[model samples]
Target: MIVEDSAVVRHLLAHLVSRDPRLELAAAVASAEEALAEIERVRPDVISMDIRLPGLDGLEATRRIMAEHPTPIVVIADAVEERGLRISMNALRAGALTVVEKPLGPGREGWEAVAEAICTQLFIMSQVPVIRQRGIGGMGAGPGRAASARAGVPPFSRPSMVGIAASTGGPPAIARVLGALPADFAAPILLVQHMGASFMEGFAAWLDGLVAPRVLIARDGMRPQPGQVHVAPGNRHLSLTPAGLLRVTDTPPVGGQRPAADVLFDSMARALGPRAMGILLTGMGEDGARGLVAINSAGGITLAEDETTAIVYGMPAAAVRLGGVSASLPLDGIGPRLLRAIGGTLEATGGQ
Candidate 1:
């Protein structure tokens, strides 16, 4: 289904969907209200939604759809303006799987390529399995949780920094983890989320609103501080120097990601050693597996989201298979676990 208000853009999207052999358009509606009302009948495997709509908007529609009928949704926006970018990010936070820029207008250079990109994204998103919106709470007690509590904050280590990596169904996952943290969270956090370049600024802004911690786009020479979360900018590899200052690199993409989680994890391992905490969240690839291994080998604590709660379970599962994860926890448990680890008391109860 395509939910876009503009007739021109809706026509373009419908044309692209029709041209793709792998996709079939279920419904093309002009407003979010119409899409919501007709969604049950349309029953699209995936939805292509525009952020700006006539009524209810894409973000609210996404939230409602995910709550009632979980389906993968990809938000589309012309991200040229800051408002559009912000709205796109809001859609993602509301459970849209990914955000893509709208196809350029006719006669613009590379318009065809842009349309193809959207088609490809739609196909990819359609393949993703999504779950209904459940509140952020520990799913259930498992052996992993017991073992994590028993380990009791690995001897003689104190976490100085936190590193997180995610993609695909990441925005909401990141929000859940970070939103659970207290405002006085002492360790600075570094996040690498694979997303389009146009969405970076707005993503950071959106995250700031969701979490208690101050969020900023990581910049070269900036020093990360406690109570702040630094997000790696799009298309740039964000790493930390030995002195703990931020380093944004234009180096070639590692594992096909410029802001690869591996790059950030390896750098954090080298810089903070046993004082670092590495977290691999829900994503679609193996980008963070090796980095989690590096952190584990360096004596840093490594955690991966457990399969039951993860949106895709690919990245975290890869790390678990590689023997890199120190503890695999559900989404809600991660924040509490991290706080305990940081406080040097990884007990079952609230030591942190």
Candidate 2:
């Protein structure tokens, strides 16, 4: 299923989805109201939603679906801006799972690769349990909500900053963890994800909607602050100094990426030491392994996302193998675990 106001885009997306043997078009609609009807009637396996629509916008529709039907949604939007970006980001926050910009065609932007990416995200998010948090009051119950209230985890406090890394299935995974955090979260989050340059700006803009913290692409020498997220640009390596300054470089790619997790992890180890908490989530490589080892050795907390929920399980699994991961946890537990880890409590989850 695809929801877009443009008839041409609807046709293009339908054709692209049909090309995949693993998927079939359930329906295509131009309005959110019509989309809701089609979704209930068809019970689609997945939905590719646009931020703009004829009547009810895509983001509002996403909120309604999540609050009601709770199905998997993947956002396909134009570039991020005030309203458009807000709509797309809100969709993710409302449990849309992932956000990707529209391809560069007249209808669907004509980018075949973008269509493939959307399909891949939908397929992957579908397999993961759609554990939507009803409200903060639901914490400490159910699998998804219980993870949020696990005892002995430390509450977030004043930490100079936080550093995180992910790859492959990173965007949605990162959003899930970040969305759970409170708006007043008292530390800046530095992020590294192996993604293309074409999408980095949009990615940051998209993230700003899902979390309370402001999200921006990192600028060299920027000082870390609470309630903000700095993302490593596609062609840059991001690091931190002992004094808490961001270091973004155009250095050669390490571990198959310019914004390699290893570089960020190692830098955090030297800079923040025990004050740091490193999180390794779903992905396709071992870039963060050694750096996590350094983090753990320096008394910082390290966490790996558990395989059962990961789209690829490569990076977090690799960090675990390196004997650096202090705890291995399911994706939903990551935010609460991080809060605990940063607060100086590290009870075993028996997860890995």
Candidate 3:
């Protein structure tokens, strides 16, 4: 299903969907109101949503749909407009699966590539299994508290730095973990999230507002500071030098992902060794699995988000299957576990 206000874009998407025999055009509506009304009848496996609409905007529509009837949604956003990028991030936070930039003019150069990319994204998103919204309170302080209470003697030493990698349903998960940490957290944090180029600035800005620590896009030659979070920019791979300074490279995508989790995790394992910590969160594919193994082999603490809380279990599952995870935890528990790890209070019990 496609929910777009522009008739031309709607028709274009419909035609594109028709061309792919694997996809079915359940419905295409012009406004959010119309989409809300028609979605129940269509029961689409996935939806391509536009940010701007006549009645309710795409973000709100996405929130409502996820609350009432959970389904994977991909935001088709205008790449040039800053507001479009901002709303697209909000849509992801509201439970939409991913965002794709709207193709430029249909007849312009590179149109075929853009069209093919959109089709590919749609097909991939349709296969993802979506869960119902459990509300904000359900996400905070439950199993994590129980686990923390049972912790015995601490095994892992305090880490000098922390490296995290996520994709797909990562925005909210990142926000949840960061929000739980204090402003005075002692370890410098590095993050790599797979997102479109147009959305990077908006995502960093949005994340800054949500977390206590300073959140900024990573820059070459910058040294990460404690209590601050550095996010890899789009189209660049973020890594660390042996001197512990940040390095952004134009290296080719690893496992088809620029700013791949493997790059950052491998760098941390080599640079900080036992002094580093690696976290693999909700995402698609096995990009970070080998890096997590590297971290484990280096005697560093490696964690993967538990399958129950992960929006997509692909990345973490790969790490767990490879025997890379030192501990597998729920979303809310991860921050608390990290806090305990840094505070030297967590037990030595191996992977759960």
Candidate 4:
């Protein structure tokens, strides 16, 4: 399904969906109401929706769809406009799976590449099965779990700090993982997302509403505390001090990211070592791979979202290929699994 107010953009998006052998357009409409109706009736595997529309708009439609259908939805928006960009991100928070900038047109030079990106996301979304098990699933008897146990990674001596890194379709992806955690969660979570300077604050705020943890933009020099979720601000690197202090830096972009995941993971390896639980979610680059290896070397437990659930498999796949990921679980398993990793019981866990 494609939902856009402009006739030209709608037609172009429909054309893009038609090009993929695995994807078929169920409907294309000008308003969110009609889009919602079509979704209720068609129950598509994926949706390419616009951020702005005649009624209800895309974000609201996405929120309602998630609350009702819980199907994967991809939002389409213009990249150049600030408001459009913000709304597109908000749509992600509303449970949309990914966001792709609308293509220029069939006549435009880069249209084929744009269409390819859309098809790729749709195919990925179609393949990810909804996660069912809570806490830890099977006792895989893998070396990873045995190593974590030997290191005393769980049942901590003190409050553990959580570190995560992501990019590309990270906003909604991370939210889905974190939203499963409780507000009074016993640990502190720090997130490093590869996004521009303008979007982090709003993203953090949007996540706070969805999760029990108090999500805040990380500040330099703050001491680690439980029940708080801190997100690395845009255009700055976030690292943990050996003293367990939150250190924010305007360092050179590592892996082409100012708020690079590698820097954060390296710092966690040095500071918290085996006491930290490091997670690498979905994204398009190899930003977190080396750092995850560092964390694994430090005896800390590391997890990567499995390829099945990732919006873009690049970052997590890199970590997996590097042999840094301790356990590769689906997105829905992350929150509950993290709780179990911290010694919480499966019966007590709950999240949408």
- Measured by TM-score, the strongest candidate is 3
On lDDT, the leading prediction is 3
**Candidate 4 segments whose C-alpha is farther than 4 A from its true place:** 1-50, 60-90, 93-159, 344-352
Ranking by lDDT: 3, 1, 4, 2
RMSD of each: 3.5, 6.7, 4.3, 7.6
61-178 per-residue lDDT for model 1 (tens digits) = 9889988989999999876777777777777766788988898677888787777878888998899888776534434434454334554555637788999999887887898888
lDDT of 4 by residue, 34-127 (tens): 8777777887777778887877988888777777777777777776666777787777655676666678877687677677877787777765
Range of the 10 consecutive residues with the lowest summed lDDT in candidate 2? 343-352
Model 3 per-residue lDDT tens digits across residues 205-316:
8888888888999999999987789999988999999999999999899999998999999999999998889999999999999999998889898888887788899999
- lDDT of every model, 2 decimals: 0.85, 0.74, 0.86, 0.75
lDDT by residue (tens digit), candidate 2, 1-352: 7888888878878887787877788888888898888777888777888888877988789888877777778788776355686676556546676667676664445466677776776676565555443632233312422222345544322234577898755776788788767655667789998765656887787787667678999999999766678999877999998788999998888876788889998998888877777889887769898889988887777777877666567888788888887777777788876555444211222211
Pick out the ten consecutive residues of candidate 1 with the lowest summed lDDT.
Answer: 343-352
Query: Candidate 3: what lDDT?
Result: 0.86
Give per-candidate clash totals: 0, 5, 0, 1
lDDT score for residue 159 of model 3 = 81
